[model samples]
Target: MEIIIGPLILVAQVALNLFWWALVISAILSWLVAFNVINTSNQFVNSVGSFLYSITEPALRPIRRFVPPLGGLDMSFIVLLLIILFVQNVLARLQYSIG
Candidate 1:
């Protein structure tokens, strides 16, 4: 039981780390989409954007609220990424302490 539970927790932590990384990548892609480098009207782009938004929005919405758009540029994503990194480091340390 202990062995199984331990690995499960590790896997969960890794999944969260990967999710944060994915959010960063998706955020970058979103900027491209906004700039029309990637066709936002395309089905593929829409699907990808929707998926990323679902995962990242909960964390990002608050940041977005406080930081309004500036000169047509959105800095909320970068702020969200910073927060994610902070959380990731904290979680890593927490896992270390647990082990």
Candidate 2:
């Protein structure tokens, strides 16, 4: 059990870390696009933006449904990040115990 569960927990922790960064990048990219700091007309910028949207939007949509944006600010991103952080911490504790 320890052999299998330990590796699985590690993988989950790594995935969560990647997801946490993805959310942060997506939020910053959205801001840049909104402010015209980065134009979607540029092929590279558009491609990255689209890719980020595709990946992050699914996770965010449900959160948005419940929380809704407040005063032109989206709190869903923050909420999602917090949830991810909590999960990561839980994984860490689990991994510690298993190992």
* lDDT of each residue in 60-96, candidate 2, tens digit only: 9999999988999999999999999899898889888
Q: What is the C-alpha lDDT of each candidate?
A: 0.79, 0.91
User: Which candidate comes out best when scored by TM-score?
Assistant: 2
What are the RMSDs of all candidates, in order? Answer: 2.8, 0.7
lDDT per residue as tens, model 1, 3-74: 665576678778878887878778788779877899978998889889888888887788988999899877
Q: Score candidate 2 by lDDT.
A: 0.91
Off by over 4 Å in 1: 1-9
Question: Residue 9 in candidate 1 has what lDDT?
Answer: 62
Give the Å shift of residue 73 in candidate 1: 3.1
Candidate 1's TM-score reads: 0.71
Candidate 2 wrong stretches, greater than 4 Å: none
Q: Top model by lDDT, which number?
A: 2
Measured with C-alpha atoms, the lDDT of residue 8 in candidate 1 is 65
